[model samples]
Target: MSENDIERLQEVLRDFAKERDWEQFHSPKNLIMALMGEVGELSEIFQWLTDSEASHLEGKVKNRAREEIADVLLYLLRLSDVLDIDLIEAAHDKLEVNRQKYPVAVFKGSSAKYNEIKD
Candidate 1:
């Protein structure tokens, strides 16, 4: 998604919370907790599914997954806004760090952690 999309969503979430008088409850810690809850809900959709089934969700299950994912995104965006973090930039920076930690030459086709990858 574009930065504009993220900014727009942030504005929408800000207005939503303000309109509901929920700013006080939107602290970073609370938002993170809510995010984790959403994540759990999302995970539940695939809890007993085979890998193929989880990858190819359909009908009601897919719709539920969509809603749960939206919840996760909303809570994450709210938390980032509360903490004054630019999520896009932070993600880019983290990706760069990960690239350095797990170089293509050493990490290709490997599922090992960075520390476990042989030189």
Candidate 2:
């Protein structure tokens, strides 16, 4: 069920888009670009906000961040739909590979990748 959830979600999104005739504009390239655009927008929300200050932000700023995050995710969901990619399974697969590339023992305390650590 976990493996199929993203596909199911994509299907629901596709249906919703179809209902609104949005499929016509959901080309793979456009969706991918839009996904990046949303990411940039989301990042810009905190571009200069200090981490401590950001942590203290509430209400409107938080809501704006949530909306930006949602926009990024929507574009990602639609991008997955356009590419026929199963994001849940794909995410699981990525995590598995990342586990090997970033074992906890070495990468846990730092942000460096397994390959970047000194042997």
Candidate 3:
């Protein structure tokens, strides 16, 4: 997604919380906890499923997963807004860091941690 999408989401979330006077409870810590709960709910959707099953979720299961994922993202965006973080810039910076840590030649086809990968 583009930066505009993130900005729009942030604006929507900000207005949503403000509309209900829920901004008082949307502190960074509270938002983080809520985000974690949504992530757990998302994980529950895939629990006990095989890799293929997880990848090929159907019907109600997929719908539930989608809702849970959206919850996670909404909370994350709200938290970022509260903390004045630019999520897009942060993601780009993190990707650059990961690229340096996980060079293609050394990390290709491997799932090991960067430090564990030998040159």
Candidate 4:
């Protein structure tokens, strides 16, 4: 919800890794690979769903989706911690760049890539 929330989650993840002696294996490359795996698992859940079906997930499907999302976030947070990157600030910075690249007046309701948006 806030930067403090991200920090708290990062602390919990740090302790979790330390307790398990997993810090040795938590390199950026390994964490990014694990994060990608979790993302693939999450993608699999939606692979067969129609647009409408995907929008309204529920029951076991939703539970599994949540678990996969948690896995992805944990790995991502762990990776960011190891790299000393502020994930929230990085996200905010990226969003600002995107806003400039895709100004609403020219991009609203359009899904074109920034470079492809014509005058």
Higher-scoring candidate on TM-score, 1 or 2:
1
Backbone clash pairs in model 3 (N, Cα, C under 3 Å; residues 3+ apart or in different chains), count: 0
After superposition, candidate 4 runs with Cα above 4 Å error: none
| Residue-pair clashes per candidate | 0, 0, 0, 0
Q: All candidates' TM-scores?
A: 0.97, 0.85, 0.97, 0.97
Model 2 lDDT per residue over 2-25, tens place: 647756767888899999998999
Question: For candidate 3, what is the lDDT?
Answer: 0.93
Compared with the true structure, what per-residue lDDT tens digits does model 4 show for residues 41-77?
9999999999999999999999999999999988988
> After best superposition, candidate 4 residue 2: deviation in angstroms?
1.0
Full-model lDDT, candidate 2: 0.83
Give me the runs in candidate 2 sitting further than 4 Å from their true place: 1-8
* Per-residue alpha-carbon lDDT of candidate 3 for residues 69-91, written as tens digits (9 for 90 to 100): 98999999899999999999999
User: Pairs clashing in candidate 2?
Assistant: none
Computed on alpha carbons, the lDDT of every model, listed in order, comes to 0.92, 0.83, 0.93, 0.95
lDDT per residue for candidate 1 within 35-88, as digits (tens), equals 999999999999999999999999999999999999999999889988989999
